[model samples]
Target: MRTTRSYLALALAFVLVLTGQSMALARTAPGPDGQIVLCTGTGPVAVLVDDQGQPIGPSHICPDCALSLFQALAETAPEIAAPTSWLRAHPIEFTLVFHSPAPRPAVARGPPQAA
Candidate 1:
């Protein structure tokens, strides 16, 4: 009986650790539009804006990947707004945004080479 109990406990612990790891990988993001967006693992994503079209803090459960993206955006887009109070009260919506690299302008060919 003692051996059986010990085995069961060990199995349970292993299962718990696996579950936690899975959850960490799948981080969740919140949108201000009352929607929850989950990081499906594509690239850096942004949170949706609320009714006022403003960014909001993540919901209670901040996923690891989502947090990383958020921190990056916060550094660049400091002007981005968030609904702190609303997020505190309601569940946050996590969404993904696809961002493309900006194109560089071509250099002028010396004032159009007077033909």
Candidate 2:
């Protein structure tokens, strides 16, 4: 398991380096009508364009982007403990008893064995 974790960490680091290099090499240019262009999985796509076919200034994050960020955060967020009040209201009780093991019965000895 430790070896597997080390290999996984190395692989993740390599992937991140490659991704960073690729992103650094690639550049996104504006569309013909000065529309905001963003690189998508398929290709560069025009986004945040106005009715006048011009790029709109970034004022606020789009709902879809906000939702995606929220989901990412939720996935990475650490687990939270249950409320203290609730735990106090509903307490758990248990009894742990340890008993000695039973003694084994001894078998009767057989008659003297032949020489």
Candidate 3:
């Protein structure tokens, strides 16, 4: 099962590579359970959602770029008590943004909407 998930992740990475978005060396940030693995890419933050496609919390942003992760967490710390499980992670925006010179890929897979 781990291998399968790795393959899936690899394939997604490959697809990103095929596009013009320039990605740096891979880095992943899985949730406390390790099942919800977020990563660095060219786009907006990944939204945490429930099974019905409703957002349970703010999107998870990449740590290397933009603002401090600690600050982002502090702003949203009150939402840690949400119930139920997520159906799947969705990346959004598809912007090639990063702190360094490398062009990042899509940050998350969900549609673009206000937080």
What are the models' TM-scores?
A: 0.25, 0.27, 0.18
- Residues 44-115, candidate 3: write the lDDT tens digits: 556565555555554344535545655667845545667688788787867776766678786868867887
Off by over 4 Å in 3: 21-115
State in Å the error of residue 90, model 1. Answer: 34
lDDT of each: 0.68, 0.67, 0.57
Top model number, TM-score? 2
Residue 53's lDDT within candidate 2 is 69
- How much is the lDDT of residue 54 in candidate 2? 66
Model 1 ranges off by over 4 Å: 28-115
Winner by lDDT: 1
Which scores better on TM-score, 1 or 2?
A: 2
Provide backbone clash counts, one per model: 13, 0, 11
